[model samples]
Target: MDLINFWLENLPTMIDGLIVSLQVTGAALVVGIPLGLLLALGVQAKTKAVRFSSMAFVEIGRGAPALIMLQFAYFGLPQAGISLSSFAAAAVALAWTTSAYTSEIIRAGLEAVPHGQQEAAVAVGFTRIDALRFIIVPQGLRVAAPALLGFSILMLQATSLCFAIALPELLSQAYMIGTNTFQYLPILLFAGLLYASICVPATIAVSLLERSLSKHSA
Candidate 1:
C-alpha cells in the first residue's frame, strides 16, 4: 500500500521519464523501418555485390550485443570528434540493431509473397517497382505484421539501453527511485507494470492484424 501510494504520488515524475522512453522508441522505429526495408530489398537484389554487402552489414550488427553497440556510440564516437547526446547515442544504437533484425523479417516477408502474384502484376502491365510497391509490399507487410509488431515490442524493451548512457528514461527513473527509497522490489514492479502497459496493446493489435490476414487468405 505504501509503495502504491508512493508511486501514485510520484506519477508525474515517472510519466516525465516515460515520455523520453516513448521518444526513443518512436524515433528509432521511424528511422529503422524504412532503412530496414531498403536493406531487405538490397538483400534480395539480383546483383551479387548488393546482396553480399547487405548480408555482411546485417550479420555484423546481429552478431554484436546491443549494449556494446550503445557503449561504442556513446563512448567511442567522441574520440572521432562526433559527440552525441545520450538520447542520440541510444537511438542510433537501437535503430542500427533493430534494423538488422527487421531487415531479416522484411526479407522473409518479401520472399513469402507468392511468385505468381508478382507475375500477375507484371502481366497487368505494372512495372516491377509498381508491383513491389503495390502488390508485393502490401501482402508482405500483412504476412509480416505479427513479426514486425514483435520486433517493435522488442525495440520498446530495448529502450532500457538509454540508462547506460545516463538518459533518464523509465528504467533510469526507476533506478533513481530505488536508490533513494532502497525499495528495489517495488520500484522494479512499477517499472514492469509500465512496460507491460505499453506492450500489451501492441501485442493485441498485432494479433488482430495477423488474424485478419489469415482470414483473408482463407
Candidate 2:
C-alpha cells in the first residue's frame, strides 16, 4: 500500500518523463533508420574515399559514448549559437548513436546475402542500383531486423540522457521523486522496472522477427 501510494502520488511526473523518453526514442528512429541504411550502402561503395569516409564516421560515432555525444550536442551547439531544445538534443544524440550501430547491422545484412544472388540479378538485366533496391534491401532488412530492434532497445536505454540537459525523462523523473520523497532506492527500482517493461516487449518482437525471417529463409 505504501509503494502503491507513493507511485500514485508521483505518477504524473513519471508519466511526463516517460513521454519525453519515448519522444526521443521515437524521433531518433524515425530519422535514423533510413539514414543508417544509406550510410551502410555508402560505406560499401566502390570508391575508396566514400567507403572509407563512411566507415570512419560510423567508427567514430560508435566508439564515442552516448553521454559524451549528448554533452556535445547540448553544449557544443550553443557555441555556434545554434541552440536546440533538450528533446532535439536528445533526439540528435540518440539518432547519431543508433545510426552507427544500425549501419553496421545493415552492412552485415547486405553481406549476408549470397554473392550469387547479386550476380543473378545482374544477369537478369537489373542494374546494380536497381538490383540492390529491389532484391538486396528487402532481404537485407529481414536479416537486419533483429539487430536493428536490439539497437532500438539500446537507444531507448540511452534516452536516459534527457536528465543531463534538464529534460525530464523516466530516470530524471525518478530522480526528482526520490529527491522529494527521500526514497531513492525504491524510486530507482520502479524506474528500472518501467524501462525493463518497455524493453521486454521490444526484445520479444525482435526474437519473433528473427524467427519469421528464418522460416522464410528456410
Best by TM-score: 2
Candidate 1, lDDT over the whole model = 0.88
Lowest summed lDDT window (length 10), candidate 1: 9-18
The Cα error of candidate 2 at residue 14, in Å, is 0.9
Which RMSD values do the candidates have, in order? 1.4, 1.3
Cα error, residue 125 of model 2, in Å, equals 0.7
Tens digit of lDDT per residue, candidate 2, span 55-116?
A: 88788789999899898898889999989888888888888888888998998999998888
- What stretches of model 1 exceed 4 Å from their correct place? none
TM-score of each: 0.95, 0.95
User: Positional deviation of 139 in candidate 1, in angstroms?
Assistant: 1.1
lDDT values, one for every candidate:
0.88, 0.88
lDDT for model 2 comes to 0.88
